[model samples]
Target: MALPLSVLLVSLLLLIAVPDIYATFHHGVHHAVGSRAHHRIVLPKHHRPKFKPGPWKQAHATFYEGGPGSFGGACGYDDVVREGYGLDSTAAVSNVLFNNGQACGACYEIKCINSPQFCKRGQQSLFVTATNQCPPNYYQSSDNGGWCNEPREHFDLAEPAFLKIAEYRGGIVPVQYRRVPCKKQGGIRFTITGNPYFNQVAVWNVGGAGDVVSLQVKGNKKLKWTPMKRSWGQKWETNAMLVGESLTFRVRASDGRYSTSWHIAPKNWQFGQTFEGKNFK
Candidate 1:
């Protein structure tokens, strides 16, 4: 009654192979389902936040045309250069929002809500970057108590951007604004100016919550990083003589996140030289 050896061997192989086959099939199914679920959970590109959202505020906005004197304001950016940030028809806010240049480079979404003449069709919203400060002296001198003197959250928009939301005759319109992340193209750029002994750097083309609040610099010769003062607008300056061929910078945004750019300045770096570095976005 003994079975054939060949039959016994074949039976054993089937027992082993069946389980292996089932396991392989089950694993494939699980992997496919997991991948599809992950894709579904991802957010859309446009809806993504440029930076973490802050509190919303109601305010008023006025527009002005860019002319000869419209170039530089309290933020210290030279509109004539056109290479620096905020030279375009952007928006300037009062000291309450400017925070003495701390708000420089901050981005906001402003929507025209009131003023029937401007919002007759529907509310129009525009995303603007803060590049300048609305001076308080101008407000004090105006008869109507200019927007600069307003309680807080007042915006002086560039004429072109403002017209997108309101008519030219509207002059001033009620608006609601909220802080949003800045979406920038490519990496951040560092422009070095002044002599090596006293270098001033302007950081621009920042993405992902683009405004810089604090900046620090260090060279190969220095054992520690030196904090740079906000010279004006987006420029940070250090009086220390950077003798090394390369330099590094650590930048902190308004959201309290830090991004470092290492060895951005090359050897033989001269005044008015610009180097592009990694971005936050």
Candidate 2:
């Protein structure tokens, strides 16, 4: 049978267009579209590590009364503001989000939802660092004073951070939140402490993944790196006498990224002094 002229032309058009359509769809699926941006995040050149942003999930938020001297908690940070985290941009996440202190320094974006009366619509979401932990109250039920109880995700935001998303009078408001990479200003800061026989270091001002998973230290006289154990939270310690020797540090974050800071601490470094070193992207 002889095909009509119009039918042959239609068949030819389909062959040409179908492949292009399939390619476009395939690219979209592989690239993965990012979430709608409430506000543009400007990352620094050294802080531009690509991270897979998690999906927004439901949670609850409340505020606690705290100030500069009182902001630090389980993360080993003595003063969050002095440590580079803004007073209004810090929060204490519950156990689920705190990840047993591993969540320290991790950033998150949160916004109030389902509470039009208190939620300020069209405003940028609240971006905060997990500086502390909202401990679970075994003495109270999850619905009562135990809002941070197990299985319940909650955020005890700093008063200022809370007000950015909801009115203080709201006490607690429904919110949607997701993990975000921290954008830090400078290199990682290491606060050294302890006696000559023991060395305890607190890691802070971290960027990128924002949480340290493992740390190793080497002295100027030593060829092999000495692994440091996590003393508590972001604090890692080693018994090796690093005194009188210039110190180098290797830090690894949760994202599997590594940064080496060579001779960050001087040979004459003293306890209670802090030094800056290379940061991760």
Candidate 3:
């Protein structure tokens, strides 16, 4: 039997309301059908985030376009980007020491910078002997990735080597040398502690790098480091040299096999003292 007038009126209102509510549903179903027929895009499981083109020519870019999100690459997500800073597996300069003690991903993400992706080529990272602290003149080692000098480090602080005025008139008398008060270039000085040859006060490395050691007097022009006296490590003591501000500096001790810090500044800057047994390393 045909519906009554009132029933028919209600049915018409329901039909009108259904179209508006199901419009999006119908559209989505048709779109899916068309996409499948044309093989334009796969289903949800296979769908990928639309990737932008790479080779981003922007200033200080972070993420590159058209790169995979979950692939292990050397250049893109290495320790530099994920841990420190630098290009993707791009050959990192061994001399510059970057800050790594901070939090990771706390800064920019990989692909954000035009870093290497380690896809075509593998990764290259340093194996610093210790943490990330670097030395003077030299920053990071080119190979091992720790404290290193500019070239093949040729330095040492041996006796008979002159400081302010080389020639000493009196016996192993008391002398004075200033402390490296600056932050960038620090210095160390000390009195001749051991006379290896009985003629020259000699200091050698039994570990770390080979005979790559050099010494110098500390001053503003000499080297710079933490200016605070407490940071100097030890209270710089004087053996023959009496009074304050005396130090003996040694650095760049590398033997090619086990290269490491020749000597670390003691608790306080002191002369006539020697640091041994893998202290620097």
Candidate 4:
């Protein structure tokens, strides 16, 4: 009962004409397995876009008293105006934007939107430096006293900054904000603290991408660079015995830019004294 030769040849031709089930088609063209269509493009996690560029994001803003002695907040930026931030142009951001104090010295342009009644008539926007953290009050709901809670972006702006964009009575106004380059006057400033064996430095008055990511300290011209760990907020500390030596610092900003300040501190520099160094563009 074997098939005839002609029938067997026709069946073999039909099998060869059949298409593959897994084949990818484009423009009615069938591509077989192992073609370029089967390949995928993958990007590294660090290379992925973290935020959209040039887009204003939604957030809430309220005013806070920006007194002389009470200007500093969680980021330890004491006396913001004295640290080169202009008068009343400072804010305490919510946890998300604060990014565990990495957002310290980061400048932002904020404006009241969708509320014409409260928004200023001709003022464009207001620039403010992130000087503190608006901690979330978990006792209240997100819309109430917990405005700074997780998943919510809030800005506790200085009273003057808020007034520039909205009326004082607005209280909490809906706003749009975007990160902007910090326009600092002079160079980066470092305030040295801590004991002789441990040095805690508070960095401020930074320009460009103001938030510092990595920092290294060289005790003097003869010593190698030693990396400093972030103690808290913008304060970086090192346990090296760098007492009585002129100090130089290499600072790396969040934008991956680096700046080196050579021998900015004198050997006789006091613990309470602040030293100015080179800054980023």
Best by lDDT: 2
User: Whose TM-score is greatest here?
Assistant: 2
Per-residue lDDT tens digits of candidate 3, residues 145-242? 33134432211111112111122231121222211111111122222332322212222212222122232323223333312111111122122222
Candidate 2 residue 1 C-alpha distance from true site, Å: 80
Candidate 2 has its poorest 10 consecutive residues by lDDT at 34-43
In model 2, which runs have C-alpha deviations exceeding 4 angstroms?
A: 1-49
- In terms of lDDT, the poorest run of 10 residues in model 3 is 101-110
lDDT of each residue in 130-234, candidate 4, tens digit only: 888898899999898788999999999889888888999889989999888887888999999988887899999988877888889997655579999987679
TM-score of each: 0.75, 0.80, 0.18, 0.78
Per-residue C-alpha lDDT of model 2 across residues 126-231, encoded as one tens digit per residue: 9998899999999999988899999999999899888888887889999999988888888999999999998899999998878888999998995369999998
Scanning candidate 1 in windows of ten residues, the lowest lDDT window is 80-89
Better of 2 and 3 by lDDT: 2
What are the lDDT scores of the predictions, listed in order?
A: 0.75, 0.87, 0.26, 0.82
lDDT, candidate 3, equals 0.26
lDDT of 4 at 223: 56
